[model samples]
Target: MSKELRSNFHEQLTEIRDGIAQMGAGVTELVPRATQILLDGDLEAAEYVILGDNEYDAKAVELEERCFSVIALQAPVASDLRSLVSAIKIIADIERSADLCVNICKAARRIYGHDLDPSLRGVIQKMGNQARVLFKESTEAYLNLDGPRAAALHDMDSYLDDLQRQFIQVIFESHAAGTIDLQVAVQLAVVARFYERIGDHAVNVGDRVRYIVDGWVPEHPYAESDNDPPEIVDGVIVPAGQS
Candidate 1:
């Protein structure tokens, strides 16, 4: 590639990176906003979060197109190609995290008049804050190419998972004690899962960041190449017609 062409390519890559960071920042902001809407029964804030998801969806589609264009036009090899591919995956994670926030808001709207006990409220707050922190750190790791910090997000997600468990237990306790009705408890339980799923998405973003930095593939059964035939063992079922 000519020097001028290389320079333009790098510039395009920078713009894509900046766009991802901007999206990540926006999604992180919604976490706390949704949590507050739930805790305070703020109908206005719930509407804002729900409406904001459309913009994020549009942004994600645009970012994905840009990444695809860069790959087609520049044919980036090795790390450049990996980075662009990872950016595409990271965009999906960020967008889904935003959708989870929207779900939380929708849950808030569903239980609009129900008041949460202090214990349930506290746990929800902690999960929201933790999810925000995870996304922020993952975005920074991507921007900085800090693989170690990106890898650490998985461990950090455990706290959010624990919070979800605790929150569910509280919901059950509150329902038993007649503090909250069963319908409200059910909505709150789903809301807890949404927060936990956001943390999962954040960890996914971090995994993509690690891939960009070092070509690391997370270990999973489906990570193998499609052309590779499945191995058959005693009583083990391989893919159909591939044994």
Candidate 2:
């Protein structure tokens, strides 16, 4: 490549990286804001989170366009091809993660105007906090291209799965004992499921980071059990088995 063309390519690559980082920051903020809305039972805050989803969508679209431009104009190959591919994939994951936050906020609004048992609220809030931390760490790993840090996020997600399982058991126990209203138990179950999914998406970002840097997809770090684990026969885990 000519020096001028190389320089342009590097600049475009930098812009893509910066754009991803900006989107990551925006998505990261949504997690806490959505959780706060849930904790405070604030309808307005929930609405704000729902509206903000569009912002993330727009950013993802912009990043996708940029990646397409780089591929078409620069004709990247090998590692550059991997980086562009990873950027495209990561944007989708990031956008979905943002959407999950919006969904959580919507759920919070649905549960608003009703008095939730404090114990259930406590559990949901704790799960939200844990998810937010994972989101932040996973994005940081992506921005830094730190495979080791990205690898570590899988363990954090495992903690989230354990929390979700414990919360599910609590809900079932409460329902069986007639301690929690069935409707409330169901709502809490949905909330727990959302939190678990958020953790999964964060792990996806980590996997994409590995793909970009190492040109290989990593196994899902959050698989529940060794027995009957999600099939990762090759580098890529089968989507069907991904929780």
Assess candidate 1 and give its TM-score to the true structure: 0.90
RMSD of each: 9.0, 7.3
Q: What's the CA RMSD of model 1 in angstroms?
A: 9.0
Best by lDDT: 1
Error of 1 at 236 (Å): 38
User: Which residue pairs in candidate 2 have backbone atoms (N, alpha carbon, C) closer than 3 angstroms, thus clashing?
Assistant: none
Query: Candidate 1: misplaced stretches above 4 Å?
Result: 221-243
TM-scores of the candidates in the order shown:
0.90, 0.86
Q: lDDT of each structure?
A: 0.84, 0.77
Candidate 2, residue 101: how far the Cα is off, in Å: 0.7
Give, for candidate 2, the lowest lDDT window spanning 10 residues: 225-234
What lDDT tens digits, residue by residue, belong to model 2 across residues 1-243? Answer: 999989989899989988987888777778888888877889987887787778888889999999998899889998889889888877887787787777677667656666655666677778888998888888899889998888888899999999899889878887787776666566667767777887887888888888888876655343531112122222333332242
- Backbone atom clashes (below 3 Å) for every candidate: 0, 0
Q: Cα lDDT of model 1 overall?
A: 0.84
